[model samples]
Target: MTTCATELLDKLASRRAIVAVIGLGYVGLPLIRAVAESGLTAIGIDTDPTKIEMLKAGRNYLKHTGGEWIAPLVEAGRLRPTGDFATLAEADVIVICVPTPLTRHMQPDLSYVEATARSIAPHLAPGRLVVLESTTWPGTTTEVLKPILETSGLSCGRDFFVAFSPERADPGNAEYDATGRIPKVIGGDGAEAREAACAFYGLFVERIVPVENAATAEAVKLFENIFRSVNIALVNELKVVYRAMGIDIWQVIEAAKTKPFGFMPFYPGPGLGGHCIPIDPYYLSWKAKEFDVRSQFVELAGEINSAMPRWVVDRLAEALDRSAGTGLSRAHVLVVGIAYKKNVDDTRESPALRLIELLESRGARTSFHDPWAPVIPPTREHAALGGRRSVPLDPATIADYDAVLIVTDHDNVDWSALAEARLVVDTRNRAEREGLAGPRLVKL
Candidate 1:
């Protein structure tokens, strides 16, 4: 092992290493909490002053991450939040958890990651470990980050250790926590870097999966999300085909899931959503083009998934016309649960935004109700949908709408109350499962 790798491993083993986690958003906050909870000193660095203030005050901004967990850690002096980049020099281990969003043309935009890399490169010293937890295309660690870090005039695996470890954060998941519930996948350029990366994460993470190289580790994250995207696209395509044949896709899925083997259930939705599913596959597809290979599955899945909002709007308009003799124009439609998934406030790439826009363009007046997200926040893609607040749900409110569209199946919604709608278009199969059967109810 190299001198830097050996020193990092020794510091990690003795719990003497100070872990600096950049970006105090969804991914970084939980990781900082985990490191602190593991009895290790963690300093959270972010450019957002509001987030830094919230963390310093021992409060939590994310609904899934409780303030009770953070208060004790802050009080014990194990966790510190700051907006200064100068503190980067004090950390023995630096973890980048910034966002990697796609550009307007649906290309990989690594501005946040690149900016963070440039900022910290000046502070990187010998024996320090830098691990990137941001999701990106393969070769990002070597091609993009390594060169930026080498600006410090130090050799990477020799002067300092570097690795790629994708963050597997599923917000609002009750069964999984960032600390140890999810196995961490780590990789680096050489054996010393890989071993040092694994050993560092082994301190707080319960399971460490060391892959062949950094590129493989990056590909693993994209592959996992692409698998979901493709499978969901398959079910979504089937939902349309089954609907035209006067068959219920939800019942078919329920039956197919009964098979003990060879079948894993993936349900259809209004469209693909969340930070990963709707976005990550494009990164892989974009990367594949460099090798002169076309990723047909990814392209087809994206096409199918992207068309779902229009399909759902078309179905809703037809349902309205059939049930109430009203076209989409001037129709009062209420959207239930605007969040990407159940019980989470995160709305990145949420299908509900597209559904609302499509409905509005068709002259349908749309309103939404999400218990978690009281108001639609500004998004990188759907800035026009911002400032809209969630409408209250009740029997009277349900009866007023021409149709109630169930986009996200949040558990707290009163299904019984929703059953009273004039016409209900259930995209998530929420009504049928609740035993609400009638011509007034429609499923996609």
Candidate 2:
């Protein structure tokens, strides 16, 4: 099987490949940026009017997605943003980066991917290559997406090429560029499809490795994320155990890393978040049940990780009582950070949302301040709870809250002022790193 990079490099120089991208998410947008910068004729498709409009107007939706990179491509007419699936018929290559988010029940939700495939199926054509970049279960490309894509009477591998290349995009990391990331995996339903897909990706990516099959590529992505899920769970479990012994888990891990051999450090926090570590392992767990294999480590980690929000609430309750001699109820609890992870604005599966809900349920008035996120959107779980609103992040306002719970650690947020806060519950060690001496605060 030829790698996507080789196939792309072979054709992209001739300006022959017409690229179409589905879903303008954190994964899709950067990919389109790469495809455009590679000199490919790129078309970006999205159902979201807001995102589509933003791209068309040369505005970047994501904070890390700068307009400087996309504006030039759009101006040159090499890149386009469209809502029409009819344009897919004109594509030589199509990349699907739609989200495969989890259901509220923690089940694999393939609605977005399936819906996007169906939208493109009607326009399926010969000599076209379709690549699935959405991280999903192993059988999804073969069993789920294949059937949907072939519905247009297009026989895959014969009339069109189909492949699965799990996206390795790490949002908000400056170290890895869209095209500079090394070694993307590609697997196809057949050799021709595999070669074509690889050649297509080779145009943009620096390295591409063609795997044996789609299942291999899918499993590779699963293992990559599941490793983090399990390790973070280990640290989370250790954090809980060490908390009882009054030892900081972060310090313990940092000290362990002092031994240069046999240890890569992972941290503990309120809970898991975003699209990968928190959810990817569960897809394997679900698949394991079908094979009658119990994934105990994965399940146990999910359980412990899930319980972290409540544990955080307990810590916050204790902090409030210790600081004010009263319960958490009726306390003006302010969340210092709300994003799913530090330094990024993504809140996909953030446990901070759950902490806010738990706090409010206990009769405590809750508010949040995230400079990156001036406004919050309504979530499926918190829609009736007034969705999300903004709060003041000023110094005077910092003293107004009874206790400040730091869920995320953005670099821009004033750490000095936060350390001086009257009462603080540091989940991410943001306050501790500030070296605040007086009014020592609690840490999770």
Candidate 3:
């Protein structure tokens, strides 16, 4: 190991290293918390002034992560949030947790990751270890990030170290919310880089699984999410087939899950949601074409999952026509739960937004009710749906809509109230599970 690498490792071991985490979204916020709680000084950097202002004031913007805990951390000087990129010079270890979204053509979009690298490159100093926690294609760590970062005139393994440690953050999942409990997978540019990363993360994270190189670590994240995308696509396809055969897909899943081995349940819903499962598979598929190989199986899964929102709307339209003698045209439809999944405020790549758009395109008056997301925020694809507020879910509000479509089954939603509605199209099988199933209730 070089002298610079030895010094960095020593700082990390004593928890004296200043850890700077870029981007203050879901993944970054939890990581900074873990670092601060582990007795290390955590510097949070984001371009958004609002996030920095809130953090400085000790107020938490994210609902899943409470506000009360943030005050003490800021008060204790263990955590410092800022919008300045120049602060990277003071950081001994920097972790990039920016967004890794897809382009409109479904290609990998590394703009956020690239921009973050450029922003900090000028401030990057020798002996500082830069780790990327953003999810992207396999070669991103070496091919993309490393080249851009080298613009600082610092040679990668010898001067400044580089590593890839993909963030596995599941927002709204209480069981997995604790960052220290989750096992972190790390891959580095070289042995020294890997050693520096593992040593830093060992301060906070409970377990560290180090891989051979950065590319493998990048593949690990894509594979983990694609596994979910494919399995979900399978159950989603089964939902359609069994629905056509007049068999209840929910009941079939319940019975099939009783087996001790070779059975794990993945439920069908309006469509794929959240950051990873919807986008990461396409990242893999896009990368596969570079090697003259087509990821047809993964691409096929993406197709099935993408089509779910429209299929759910079609079922809702059919239910309205059969039960109320009216179609979606001029019908008042209420969409329950706009957040991608239950109990989370995050609406990134949520299928419910598409369902609302589809309903309105067919001339239905659409409204949504989500306890988590009170008002829809601006999204890249669903910009038109932004600024819309969640409607009340009381009995009076429920009776006004001609048909109630349940896309996301939130635990806080009152499923029993749908019994008074004229029609209930349950995509999540929430109504039946709540003991309110009847002829007017349709399950998809």
Deviating ranges (above 4 Å) for candidate 2: 1-13, 385-387
Candidate 1 segments whose C-alpha is farther than 4 A from its true place: none
TM-score of model 1 (CA atoms): 0.98
TM agreement with the true structure for every prediction: 0.98, 0.95, 0.98
lDDT of 2 by residue, 156-198 (tens): 7667778999888777677874654757899988777777777
TM-score of 2: 0.95
In the range 415-435, model 1's lDDT, one tens digit per residue, is 888767899999998888888
Better of 2 and 3 by lDDT: 3
Which scores higher on lDDT, 1 or 2?
1
lDDT of each: 0.90, 0.83, 0.90
lDDT (Cα) of model 1: 0.90
Locate the minimum summed-lDDT window of 10 residues in model 3. 413-422
